[model samples]
Target chain A: MSTPLLSQGTPPVVRKKISDPLPVRILLIGLTLLFFIGFVFLPLGLVFAQAFQKGWDFYLEAIREPYTIEAVKLTLTTVAIVVPLNAFFGVTAAWAITKFSFPGKAALKTLLDLPFAVSPVIAGLIFVLLLGSRTPFGSWLGEQGIKIIFSTPGIIIATLFVTFPFVARELIPLMEAQGRDEEEAALTLGAKGWQIFGKITLPNIRWGLLYGMILCSARAIGEFGAVSVVSGHIRGQTNTIPLHVEILYSEYNFTASFAVASLLVFLALTTVIVKAVMENRFQKNSSQH
Target chain B: MGIELQNITKKFTDYTALDNISLNIASGELIALLGPSGCGKTTLLRIIAGLESADSGKIILEGKDTTNLPPREKNVGFVFQHYALFRRLNVYENVAFGLKVLPRSKRPSKSEIKDRVEHLLKLVQMEWALKRYPSQLSGGQRQRVALARALAVNPRVLLLDEPFSALDAKVRQELRRWLRKLHDEIHVTSIFVTHDQEEALELADRIVVINKGKIEQQGTPQEVYDHPANAFVYNFLGNVNVFHGRVHEGMVTLGGHSVDAPDELKNSAEKTSQTFVRPHEIGISKIRSEGNDLEGTIREIRLLGGQIGLNIECEGFDQPIDAEIPRELYLNLQLKKGDRVFVTFNKVKVFACDYEI
Candidate 1:
């Protein structure tokens, strides 16, 4: 065996095992768990405790009130309008940014993200400056009896402006990363613009679109600062769930306020669960791919 | 379908991806667009397929000017480099997508679509994978599905962009043979883009070698290989030993030694020249030659498959000359590294050098 072994070649070298220290790895794991428990789990537990402490009777009574019921209805209605609108805006903006090059593209990108950095309070004020009685367009609109300030419509406008960036921001980088070749490939295969969008582009970006929608819906429901400034507090009218909760808290009704807050918390938590499920589905899709 | 591109050019801001170029591709002829990366081969293919619009050009297909027509109206099929098969749809549905989405007047019946998909699946030998998604298939299987899907529409022409680049060597070889067989059976005018010279040589009826946004050469594989138009074409196609020299009065001087020029080059002007010879064409012998041989020392030797490649160090040459011979020849000569050998240049090509190193 030794006589002929030299003629062929030497066997490949076995690589050495380079591993992190076991103690350091354990410490890292411990630190990660500690941070999650302290920062994320504790507050979540507190919200759950407050939600169930009063039992179903108190919760039902609180939710059945006209003010509370109206608030819930208003919040859902706002979400119904905001989610689809933001989804459309987000996807269109992302497609425009990723696929097309035109004048003021960088400026358009900056403007798309401006609402995210600016506070919702400031967002409400910007609309006020444009649509309030102070501006010429506001006066013209007022003459035509088209009011866009200090009402439910104003609250929607503010929420829409503040939550504008969520969907597109999520999708632009994703669409870019997936690339433009697939779309072009679809087009070249006898697919028109709409067909390509429906078949190739939409299917590929569906998960990202859902992710953005969930995030935008969550943020839209929990919006307080923008809606508060624009919504003139009238019971069962301009008052949204968040603004109503603030009103109840001011009246020293801590339990009811926390209860309403917990309901909003519940909606936000549903969004989190949806995001988790969506992420898990995305993971499954990617792994199968 | 016959395709004509007249003065096609595409510019992405400052970078000119495709300079003004024109080409004609006859119907039922498979062509390979071979080039290195960023050579605008894919761009040209895309322009023909209508996936990308030419900045200024006329795309005439079968005597119809279709420069402004979109891809959906072009009636051409395209296969992407990544396959680009719909991951959500199974093989059958993916192939049937184009037919299903056709306009009411052009739409096929359900059974017709099914039959067409089945026929294409059988043609690509992928009938068993009708229910499998792209992710579920291997690279070779996915490429077959892509080919099947491209053929489902019964297109006038088929285009493939590096269809087998993502596969392993064994799968690539298998697919190459399968693709050629598929093309011959279908008799579709196809254009496949690749940077691999081996793939181009093995497949295309004619190879169009593109370089730096221009067609460097286009001809049959043997014609391009045996008689390259320039140094770039020769070096890009395959491995060859290039010896820089000077030609004067029907004589070529290489490595301070004179060699008689071939009769074809008898009327050559007195000019600096470069000699092109394949490594396999050169032979090393134990018997020393007189005027036909150069004395050199073997610097290194490599046993590659059935051939032995030798780097010979000769006088007046900075770079070692490389020669490849069969293992039996090396065994007969008892050649090893550091052994002195006589290298002979039997047949060589001479070209006037435009620039010198």
Candidate 2:
């Protein structure tokens, strides 16, 4: 009788208080894994597998091609230029919006979000219509012998427009949550405006700023539609990595295209790893309290 | 250093945050600006600190007209309620921030800064956590670090905005005593804002009670607590039972009892008034008393450690009358709920209905 009572009591006690039935849990988990493999992991794995199909030598040769190297350089340059500018703009914008009250604030906030709402293709087209030789300003610019459309500067501008909102969007909520207390404390401590910004505000938002810059860099590097529209597909000139891959794939250079695409995939993987490390560090720091 | 404000006024949009207000602070006085939330006590403090500028005012600090000076130039130390210690910096760096940010000509040397920071940390009794970040410390420890950071500048005036309000009751009490002792030793002219009357009474050398952007009264703790200026001050300072009645011929009648009014209300015209009596000022007895006694049945009894509270309900009264008695007296009476008792007012203040609370 005691053994029977123990078995009846143990079964109910061992069941989890908040969980679905076993079969339903299994089904949900299986569906998630299936979607991940089919949509994400499979394509990432295939890029590398196809790139190295011939051998390491062939893959290295494809990557060392002149156009591929130029594409890599152009992508890096765009990222280097875009990330710092965006970071600066993002910090100032977030600071101004969160810390001060002024007229036109709501309008300014909505204008900042315009890039996120407008299509990248439309953004590229708008720049073209404003700067192309057909318009008066464009004609004046052309008369001055500064060709903007269908050039490298146009490519940079288009990429800049497409990736404009990444850093600011990441920072606004973080800064707003932080409030103005520390800055005010610093001010009352006889610290000047620049000192308060450098010693207090900047340090407080460093992690958010880094995260924003990383995101901006990633988008700037991978931006294709806007850059393509402005690039004019000038081989060894305005062709970024993504545009280069398109050109290579269209010319039936599958191995070369895969090799070039692998570089982007590698950068993305590195970003994810860095993000994971930062998140772990952040959580550990918070939990230490 | 002593500080003086001359007719300070501030308005936000159409709402007046602070009306024309004037105050004077003697050197080495720890004054508490006591008020409810949104009473503009904080606005006045901020104006003095130069964190906010009053629309029309002159701020005089140490006999200098510093109304137009910025916060950094004002040389005031402000401790925020949330203990706004720099989160990324450890305790040492946070304490040294003010010193390090000084102008090149006045900045301390490296060794001097370290010594000062260490001394401040020890002064706050948080030297053990010098290397810990703000997130690593408890709320009480964070506040101590914040105090050290604020004091590092050695400003003429120190302003605290509800400094200990974020801590728990036990910690708050401990910190209050510690802060009082610290102020006595350092002798900085400090002003703190608080809505807690008990805190103001316990901590401040002088209490300034503010209401609706105006100064209600300013006095020593005992003076304000013993004699509130008006109905608002009396009601705000402590819990009191209000008895609506009529005053005529130097006597105020409440329910079935009439007591002689205070001298100030004696010669006035007959008018309806509300008599305020503190719970402890009412006497409770099992038998009827000789002078102005109202008989009622005990509706409830509460044990409050040292004192026993009885709620008495009498005829012609809409609310239960609260009476607090000593434990010994309550034990001698042997009263329980539904027992008949007599309650008499020992002290009362009468105010006409026209005065708003």
Candidate 3:
């Protein structure tokens, strides 16, 4: 942190009596590059390589298939439902935790980060145990003619559990750093509580909120394990793009699976670019303070 | 009618922030709550502004009991220490925010708000920065905008918590003058809290000195400075030398010298007292003469800008006594380090013996 790297554009090279050897720095950089290319870059390149292996007409036919199109719609709908709910939960959680004091504050904060630590599969299983038809509430839901487990609602709920922490985690630190003085100033100026949040707090945290929402949306779209366990693979009803990819690959339809995966690849690249821009602005804003 | 506080006390678990305190501010009078850090001055200001609520107390504003009212209904303007200008809003919007947030029935039209905001910006001399955000302005300019924004609602009272302390020394001085002129024009009963004695003395019509969660004294600047109520008031207002002594028959005996003590000390239950004497009040002579109750060697002579500071090491005191002399008087005396000099007090402040403890 004392190095200029974190706060500003330029990172200074400090030369003391002892320093890292030239070979060691090069070795560190080279190893990271090798690992990235081997595990990450090559797989991504193969997705595009195989997507076009058949030709443009075949690629278009694969994506335009009814099941694939249905999967795309389901994924977009899931993201639309999950993202806003997650965002509302994130903003409220951040506001409550950062803006006030309560007895169980420490415990609540630790629980907010639980989703990040819990495995995606385990997160899906928690909801299954709570709401699946085998349990009493789940059985009651069934007797009431409601189908929660192995349905769209069940998949959406499981996805919610896994992608819950992104927006709140991003907002908590940012809002906490920008303390309550400005809000108090607004109150003195006769602004109502909601007005203060809408005008003052929102503008301050807009970029960070956007960053978290993007990450949350991306996580909701590409999630495979949790949605798989909960969805029950009801084709054309609950199969998301990631689950559809699994189905196509399992059937040995290599061109279609890679074609679907290339969409994910493009989404991932956009996410990386957006994350970089948001992270840059966050750093600059923090430093300016 | 103005503002009144009755037995306002605040305790933070174990430490008391404000002891049972009561004060009243007259209408249209500008006062200052002046003290060192953590002396409960800012706390008192916040409680008055309704940002803080005092436990078991009443805040009467213009003959209305408003202790439980929120800041929005309290109708008091607070300018924070570090000008809390909304970073996202431009100067014009920041100033118009108060007017626009008013209830629709009481709110003015768009053109009226525009004219008022423009007028306020012109009043604060920040018209050129109307289109600029707070981040783009310097500390002084942001503070000016904060002042303009605070005054936009035309509240009955204005409270500033160390308004100029965040700026640099030169800018702070300039802003003090600017604020005084502004207060004169608007005359909205204002109370500012500051720790700097000079700022309190120069800007405030009445200065309230607080320490250890209690009001030590409150009066006009001249009254507090010239006739301090007690030893704490004397020392807190300015630099002074304290001589520990005992009083007998209207005289105080200390450090091989006896001086006329205040008349209250003669018949007081406590025989011991301390004499407070300002450095400038105690004149210095090159040679021993009549009325020279103390003598010391000039340990150091420092020219501090327009004035000369002399540090004298005298017997019976472990620390050097600091004295200031005008540059003109210093040059005439041609004083030097290691020079022997005798000191005499022109006036002395006497207080009960427990003051030192």
Candidate 3 ranges beyond 4 A from true positions? A1-25, A54-57, A282-289, B248-250, B267-271, B291-293, B355-357
- DockQ, cand. 2: 0.37
Residue B237's lDDT within candidate 3 is 85
| Tens-digit per-residue lDDT, B126-223, candidate 3 | 88788988877777888888989999998878999999888777777877888898889889889999999999999999999999889999999999
Per-prediction DockQ: 0.36, 0.37, 0.39
What is the per-residue lDDT of model 2 for residues A1-289, given as tens digits with 9 covering 90 to 100? 0111111111225655798999999999999999999999999999999899888999999999998899899999988888898899999998999999899988888888898898888888988898887989888999999988888788888988988888888888888888998899889888888988998888777777888888888889898888888788998988999999999999998988998999999988888788778767655643443
lDDT of 2 by residue, B1-357 (tens): 488989999998868888888889999999999999999999999999998999998999878888999999898889898988888788999999999999999999999999999999888888878888887677778888898998999988889999888887777887888889889999999999999999999999999999988999999999999999888889889778988888889998887678887888899778888889999999988777685678999999999879998899988787889889999999998898999888888888888776434
DockQ category of candidate 2: acceptable
Q: Note the clash tally of each candidate.
A: 1, 0, 0
Model 1 chain B: ten consecutive residues of lowest lDDT: B260-269
Model 1 Cα shift for residue B169 (angstroms): 1.3
Q: How does each model score on TM-score?
A: 0.92, 0.94, 0.93
* C-alpha RMSD of candidate 2: 6.9
Model 1, C-alpha of A271: deviation from truth (Å): 1.5
Of the two candidates 1 and 2, the one with more favorable TM-score, higher being better, is 2
Q: iRMSD per model?
A: 10.7, 14.7, 8.7
lDDT for model 2: 0.87
Model 2 residue A73 distance off true place after TM-score fit, in angstroms: 0.7
Per-residue lDDT tens digits for candidate 3, residues A95-126, read 99998889999899999989889888888888
Better of 1 and 2 by DockQ: 2
